[model samples]
Target chain A: DAGVTQSPTHLIKTRGQQVTLRCSPKSGHDTVSWYQQALGQGPQFIFQYYEEEERQRGNFPDRFSGHQFPNYSSELNVNALLLGDSALYLCASSKLGLAGTSEQYFGPGTRLTVT
Target chain B: DQQVKQNSPSLSVQEGRISILNCDYTNSMFDYFLWYKKYPAEGPTFLISISSIKDKNEDGRFTVFLNKSAKHLSLHIVPSQPGDSAVYFCAALAPTLYNFNKFYFGSGTKLNVKP
Candidate 1:
């Protein structure tokens, strides 16, 4: 089953511009999460969405926002992009379960380049 | 402040040799740990995981050892091959009242398996 799919594999935007990245969760999965991975660094959690609502968020500022549709698709929007925003935006999908047993499957990710 | 830290920036090993990647965390509240592998221009792929209650977990050629007291963990790959070359990231599951899937990640370590 198509693990996870993201759109606009590569995007370029200038400072102060906004961009929206999309993700389609794996088939049969319900939860979606977004992460930002800068060069030479591991991904940092941005937020998580379940049941069309944001369940948790990381230390990111208000500039970053996300939405999860009823069909389990997700969108990550970054407003006023900065040079540091140039990174790989990853999307992960998982089923809602107890705690942490079910592993999260990731997508190929969207590469955002801010000029 | 990075809650999880992979002290080693990079490691190189010959094929058929054992490769060890280490990670440490400053937060005691983290009860679960995971290892993810990533290649250039790709999102991280789940590799292995270990809970705080378990000291060691093994699967195939991969073995993850955890020392809760020291807040240290390591991933060992035996008979490493060229395909094993990638960036390895250590992630911690931070308990949250709302979202249990929240994860904190390290800077990651680059592993090079030379054939």
Candidate 2:
């Protein structure tokens, strides 16, 4: 089965511009989560979506927002992007309830470059 | 503040030898720890994990050890293979009312196994 999938493998935007990234959950998975991985650093949780609603969010500011569709796919939108926003935006999917026990499979990630 | 830390940025070991990766966290509330491996241009893949209730968890050639008291964890790869060369990331989950699966990640360690 196709694991988590993300669109726009690469992107470039200028400061104050906005960018939208997409993610498709793995087969048989209902939960979708987004993360941002800076160069040479581990990923930082952006937010999680379940049942079409945001279930959790990280310390990121309001500029970062996300949505989950009925089909369990997700979109991460970053408004007013800054130079620091240039990084790999990763999307991970896993089943709920199993939570921390089960592993979250990640997508290839969207490489965002902010100028 | 960075809650999770992996001081080692990279490591090199000869094939068939033991490779150890270490991680430390400052958050006492972390309930689960996990390790993920990533190759260039790919998302991080789950390796192994250990819950706070357990001291160790093993799966085939990978093992994860958790020390709650010391707030330390480590991943040990036995008989390291050349294929194991990649970036290893350590992630910790801290219990929270809002985000149950929220994870704090450390700077990944790049491991190179030589033949």
Candidate 3:
């Protein structure tokens, strides 16, 4: 079975530009979540998508948004990118009902570099 | 504010020894905790987890301990091997009314098991 997969292993962008990263959840998974990991730091939650709607979001600004397709794939879009936005964007997938034991499997994050 | 904190940034231990990584959280509502291992250029992989109802959970050589009162959790790896050397992250899940189980992670701790 295929695990969670992410597109564009690495990206380079300039200030005030926009970038889109894609994610394919693990087989049999439905929920998709996005996270940002800076160098030498753990990931911080960006938001989560379930049933094609954004269910929850973190402290990030409005410049960050995402969408989930019917097939459980997801896309994270960041507009007006800043140097601080340069980090590893990670995608994680899990089932919905298993609330108590919600085990999330992650993908090989997309590294975004804003110059 | 960083809800989850891993004070130790790095640790080195001899092979075959017990490696203990600690994590503390400020949110009392966090009930489910997880530990993940990550290598360079790869997303974190789930290692083990423990819920608030259980103080300890074990799987093979990996174990996780949760202290609800103190809002602290820990991951223990027994007989640490060279292959076990990687960055370890601690995550806490908080349930909200929206039914979105969001995860907050700590500043990872890098472990080096010396042979």
Candidate 4:
């Protein structure tokens, strides 16, 4: 069984440009969530996708968006990237069953560098 | 304000000894909590978790203790090894009206197991 997988292990984007990071959830998982981990800090919630729609979002701005495909894969798109956008973008997958006790498995993460 | 806080930024423990990492949260609504270990340039790996209904949960070498009154939780690792030297993050499951599986993470505590 494969764990969560993410594409573009590393990315470099200039200011005002947009970038899309891909993530394939773990086998038998259906929900996908994205997080941003800045240097010396823990991962912050970005948003979550379920049933091909964004179900939950954090304090992030509107520039950050995501989509969940039918196959349970996900894409995180950040538009008009700023220098502060440089961070490790993490993808986590979980099976949404009970109300509040689902464990999430994470991917290797994509390191995004906004130049 | 940061909801979840890991007061200790770093800790060093001798190999074969017990390592304890602490975390505190301000939100009483957090029903589930988790611990994750992360190395540089990698996403977090789920360690162990505890529910609000339970005071303690143990898995293999890891044990998590939750104190709801104090709003504190801890991860205890017995026989710490050099491979355990990494950043450890404490995360809480904050299920809101819109999202049932939202997570809030602390800034993390770096654990260094010295041989």
Candidate 5:
């Protein structure tokens, strides 16, 4: 079984530009969560998608958005990105059952460099 | 403020020695805790986790001890191997009605197991 997979291992964008990264969750997973990790920092929760709807979000601004498809894949779109937006974008997959275990598997992450 | 924090930025230990990494959280609502290890250019790999109700959880080579009153947790790696040399992050999980995967991560501690 394949684990979580992300595309565009490395990306470069100019200030004010937009970028969209893709993620495919592991087999048999349903929920997807996006996170951002800056230099020398742990991953911060950006938002979470479940059943094709955004169920929860973190302290990030409106510029950060995400979508989940029926296939359990996800897309993270960042608009009008700033230099500070440059970070490693991580996608995590988990299963939420009646009694959730709250365990997650993460993708390799996409390194975004906004200049 | 950071809900989870790992004070030590880096730790160096000789091979076969035990490695103890500590983490603290300010949020009392965190009922579940986890530890993740990340190698360069890769996403975090889930190591082990413990629920707030349990004081300790042990796996083959990794053990996690949680002190609920102190709001502190620690990961102990016995007879560490060189492959364990990576950045270890401490994460806390608090489920809400909106999102069941509310994970808060610490800055991380880089472990260097010297041979």
Candidate 6:
């Protein structure tokens, strides 16, 4: 079965510019979450989408937003990006009530380079 | 503030030796702890995890230990190999009313297994 997949392996944007990254959930998964991993740091939660609605969000600013389609794919949009926004954007997928509740499979992150 | 912390930025060990990676969390409400292995240009791969109710979980040569009272967790790899060298991340799941899988991650610890 296919695992989680993300698009735009790499990207470059300037300050105040916007960028969009896409993610496809793993087969048989219905939940999608996004994370940001800065250099030398671990992944920080951005938000989570379930049933086409945002269910949870992290401490990130309003500039970061996301959506989940009916097919369980997701899109992370960062508006007015800053240099600090440069990081590896990670997408994870899991299903509710799965045998392992905390089992989240991740995709190869999209590296965002903001200049 | 970062709720999860892996104070050791790097670790090195000889092959066939025990490797212990530690993590501490400030949040007492964290219900689950997980360890992930990551390589350059890739997202984190789930390694092992332990729930708040459990003290330990083991799979083959990998084992995870949780100390709820101390708000700490640890990952142990036996007979480390060169291929095991990678950035290891610790993530904590703190679910809220709206989200069940939001995870907070640490800064990560880089493990280098020398052959």
DockQ of every candidate: 0.64, 0.66, 0.68, 0.61, 0.58, 0.61
In model 4, the Cα lDDT at residue A59 comes to: 97
Kindly report which residue stretches of model 3 are placed more than 4 angstroms away from their true locations once superposed.
A99-102
Over A1-115, each residue of candidate 4 has an lDDT whose tens digit, in order, gives 7899999999999999999999999888888989999988889999988889888889999999888889999999999999999999999998876424545888999999999
lDDT tens readout by residue for model 5, A1-115: 8799999999999999999999999888888999999999999999888899988789999999989988989999999999999999999998864113535889999999999
Clashes of each: 0, 0, 0, 0, 0, 0
What is candidate 6's CAPRI-style docking category based on DockQ? medium
Worst 10 residues of 6 chain A by lDDT: A95-104
Q: How would the docking of model 1 be graded? A: medium
Off by over 4 Å in 6: A99-102
In Å, residue A65's CA in model 4 sits off its true spot by 1.0
In model 2, which regions exceed 4 Å deviation?
A: B96-99
lDDT of 1 by residue, A66-104 (tens): 999989999999999999999999999988863365468
Error of 2 at A84 (Å): 0.6
Candidate 6 lDDT over residue span B1-115, tens digit each: 9899999999999999999999999999888788999998787898888889999999999999998989889999998999999999998877566445688889999999999
On a 0 to 1 DockQ scale, where is model 2?
0.66
lDDT of 2 by residue, A41-84 (tens): 88999999989988888989999999889899999999999999
Clashes of 1: 0
Query: Higher-lDDT candidate among 1 and 4?
Result: 1
Candidate 3 TM-score to native? 0.97
Residue pairs with clashing backbones, model 6: none
Per-residue accuracy of model 6 over A14-115 as CA lDDT, tens digit each:
999999999999999888989998888999989988899988888999999999998999999999989999999999998865424545889999999988
The lowest-lDDT stretch of 10 consecutive residues in candidate 5 chain B is B93-102
Residue A58 local lDDT, model 5:
94
